[model samples]
Target: MAGRQPRRTRIGDAVVVLGVACGLALVGVSGCGRSGAATGGGGGGTTAGEVAAAVREAADALVDAGSSKARTSMEMATGGTRVTIRGEGVYDYRKRIGRLKVLLPQDPSGAPVSRPITELLAPGALFMKNRGAGVPANKWVRVDTGTLPDGNLVTGGVTDPFTAAELLRGARTATYVGRTEFAGVPVRHYRGTADLHEAAQAASEANRRTLGAAASEFATSEVPFDVYLDDQGRIRKVRHRFSFVNEERSAPVAVASTTLLHDFGAPVDVRLPEAEDIYAGRIAKE
Candidate 1:
């Protein structure tokens, strides 16, 4: 292990895997917004085709913007374990970087998982800052993205609005529900069903990896989604509920995920931790 980038700590690896699923859940919906009461069946000019077009347009616009602030809330249950996560962060699609503060659930081994960890990400690198008793104060523990197979890292790449638009490719049906307001912003809401695997297969090579990792559960399931968009076709909100039978428990497990995107063109400043703060010191391999 000498001279190599340190292997991510055990906990860091778990975070990365979870983030893969979380990022897909967070950024998988885009495009489609307010068009003033048009329905999906060509009612008053809102056809299913038009709805799909709107989603694609919105998704394009988000990718072009490069970066934004995101807030996500999620709940998942399997067997007797239930996990809830709430996070807010700045996501940069261009660099595949995200600086997030997340609240995690208890570990599988029954250890109480840490809450609200701040993380930095890239295609090959993931760094975590957890102010726990065993960790150094203000130091970031680096987690190698290679630790997980198939290109999963810290989860912010495809979550970028621009790349996330690829998810709409799997949409089987679309309906314009009517006008609404989100956080006082005039918007439009739409509902649809999509095959998660289809979208993953259509994503860009770089994005497909992250998407593929997250779609493992929903691969065989056609899930419903509710999407809200602003007048300019920017994504405002997206909601989805996923239900499946737990393979091990032979019981039902359901997950609800919601993402809110805002602060378009926000400044995202990410800095790696200084050297002195790192707890691990690697000896050169000579």
Candidate 2:
């Protein structure tokens, strides 16, 4: 017992296991084509107001489109180590629900360390199977998104698609980077910063509390993002940079989360687990 780590410390460390393991480098994407560039107030005949308005309206546009197939990547860096987690699924924007198969990185030896986790994203809750550690293989662990320090944004290893789009509603300052082609589709690129508190204020009732919690707990409330929108104003892709305090080292951890949506009108069917199948016991820390 002399050299044993306390339970609290172990749990705190486990909280970031998915975020801190060594893994592949974050992928970089480049855009093709260019129209005009603008920054701040106005340039190239584009106004800051216009850019902000377009970015802010993206979420509503997604909802109107109905549903889409999505891919997500979250890269976290801390203490000089970086890791990436990737997920793919379909989301029904109108229903505010989705299902994703999240894949954790393999070990240093290239051996699979864990099975893919099945995650269900609902308005205010997150449900997961193969959650690792103490959770039974057949039972799902359910978490209230609003109770997480990062509002489940960075905690669950992948940002919820709806929440990611809603964050754009807080866009305060934006610049039209130029016109570009994303995944072979023509789109307008924009770079901007969003205030978490402002986003929470503009968010739907189900998301307000979660975003509010993130606003108060993250290292800073201002989130920097790059967004790509098609002619219909739907978000083709979005990437957000967030920072949060790491409880173990008392330092800030940098996180970069990317979401890509395609095939609008795609069918999505997500059913939450039954109450009896949810895990209610204390989770063990690895």
Candidate 3:
């Protein structure tokens, strides 16, 4: 195993599988600026069609290293630091079954550090695989849905915008908007929304240790998402908005900011936790 690439690590529903086997893809996107040009259906990509095209081209077009992407605009907060963010990622979808590396670049003032993070968004079931520098490698070595490993507590499984769109099969329902250029390439735009209730429930249950303390029972609302696609039907941007109709502003902190998606993939270590049996009982095809 010394020379072999690490197998995947599963944490609840997500799996992080990595091996030298998959083809690597890498591309740089010239992110749009202030006009809201940086996200799924916002300021840039001059035309909705252009935004869609960028997604299609990247999803369909395989690079020698992998494909790259960025998130729609998102408000990010951790500890006491808050920043508006547009996360970016690269992946070899053709290889390793969508192996991906996502990064949040340095802020405009270069005051905050940019993080290059790696994660796998499984084709189904909201499963994920992830890794990043400075983070405890053990977190990625296996499935761990504890608090944010990086201490950046923005709870979300589809942290990357495009993946959120792709998971819902946005290509099928997305309506064409217009066109614009991203990273010097033309992109087509599209939109769609699907429920993340199931994933959310799973996450809440997986982290039951913390959520269990809530004094009141909870009901989840339907999640509405804004999505974007390219010409070839590849997802470019995703915007997920969760509304809690039952809870008030006084609800648990996690109810407002945490996410539930966890890792699902091949096992990286030979020694399995006693909890492995629990995962084995899960309905998994990957």
Which prediction has the highest lDDT against the true structure?
Answer: 2
Residue pairs clashing in model 2 are none
Per-residue alpha-carbon lDDT of model 1 for 1-286, expressed as tens digits?
A: 0001112223223333333232122223332333332223323326766786565445555655677898876666655566677678887756666677767655666765556767675555566676353566566666444444322322322133333445555566778899889998877888777555666675555556555654552324365778887766667787666543322333334556677888878888987777776657431110
**Cα RMSDs of all predictions?**
9.3, 8.3, 15.3
In angstroms, the error of model 3 at 268 is: 19
lDDT of each: 0.55, 0.74, 0.30
Supply the global lDDT for candidate 1. 0.55
TM-score of each candidate structure, all chains considered together: 0.65, 0.84, 0.38
Q: Give the poorly placed runs of model 3, Cα more than 4 Å off.
A: 1-74, 77-87, 95-141, 144-162, 170-175, 197-221, 243-286
Q: How do all the candidates rank in terms of TM-score, highest first?
A: 2, 1, 3
Prediction 2 TM-score vs. true: 0.84
